[model samples]
Target: MTTLFSTMPSAVAPAPAADQAVQDSSPSLPEMLIAWSARDEALTARSARLPGVAYWLREVAAARTEHERALVRVVNQHGWPSVDLVGDEAATAALRILLHGQDHAFLLRCRDLIAAAVEDGACSQVHLAYVVDWCLVRLAQPQLYATAINPALGRPYPVADPDGLDTRRNEMCLPPLAQELARHQTRRLAS
Candidate 1:
């Protein structure tokens, strides 16, 4: 099914070890975003196979650890990068990294930052909704909207109020949950 993972670069080569030094040299916001996007793409591709294979799960876990470390380094070097500072695509890539991140505290901090960015018109409401709902799902709380997906199931997870989910989603400029699920199902069946 198509997901944020679907937008990742499909054929980008893995960065060489020496590239770590280049990354450490304080890359521009767009460069950092591109690097994170590649890492996120690799992690997502690995994670898709994790359910059926132990090896894939290990790879996904390892990639997650590496991704987390890289994100921490980026945040430490520069506060939450925004669309205004970078560009729409780059900031969206950075947001995707935060969405998939394992650090709860860091994700919460990013949520706050993204919320502010949205208020400042530096981010889209649709993206904010995804991040907010994802964080909620991660926290074991009921999501505001069913934007978070169950990768294994290839569909959205259960929501607190299914009947009103579309109303909430509509407010954020997202389509109804049924439409989203159908789209995912269609993509899966096609593949």
Candidate 2:
């Protein structure tokens, strides 16, 4: 339920150091990517209660968009990243950024790369599942996995095969959809 695109929280300014980390040669992609994920999570966490925080929200979105650009540059300079190349943490961070990316083609292309990495046992299938689900949601197509959801409704986006959703999700390292939804509901009640 803590997806970047799910809903806006409050606000936190993304530090300029994210770009610096990406541009700096001293820190490898893994190092910079880890920093990027930290910053992005901060922003996402700060985005929880959205009341009279539109300006900060806009700033947050702009920063995230800038993050997408930096990610693109990272991909351009160093081919598709993998656990072997950038490490598991960085690879997961890379996919998280892609989940919020606006470009469908770019997301799809990276999805393919992640899929290959999964086959090689160099990446986590859970992250790849979220990416594929996000890609299909953006395209208005039924997602094979039900990770992508409508935050307002607290329901997953349309699924391709309803009966086999849990099966597909299990293959991708996800809990059954009903269990997932129940967890979300529990969290909501607790909050």
**Whole-model lDDT, model 2:** 0.75
TM-score of each: 0.77, 0.81
Please, what is the whole-model Cα lDDT of each candidate in the order they appear? 0.71, 0.75
TM-score for model 1? 0.77
lDDT of 2 by residue, 113-159 (tens): 88888889887899789888888788889999899878778898899
> What lDDT tens digits, residue by residue, belong to model 1 across residues 77-166?
666667776777877777776776688888888788778888998878877898888888987888988888886698776688888888
Number of backbone collisions per candidate: 0, 6
| Backbone clashes counted, model 2 | 6
TM-score leader:
2
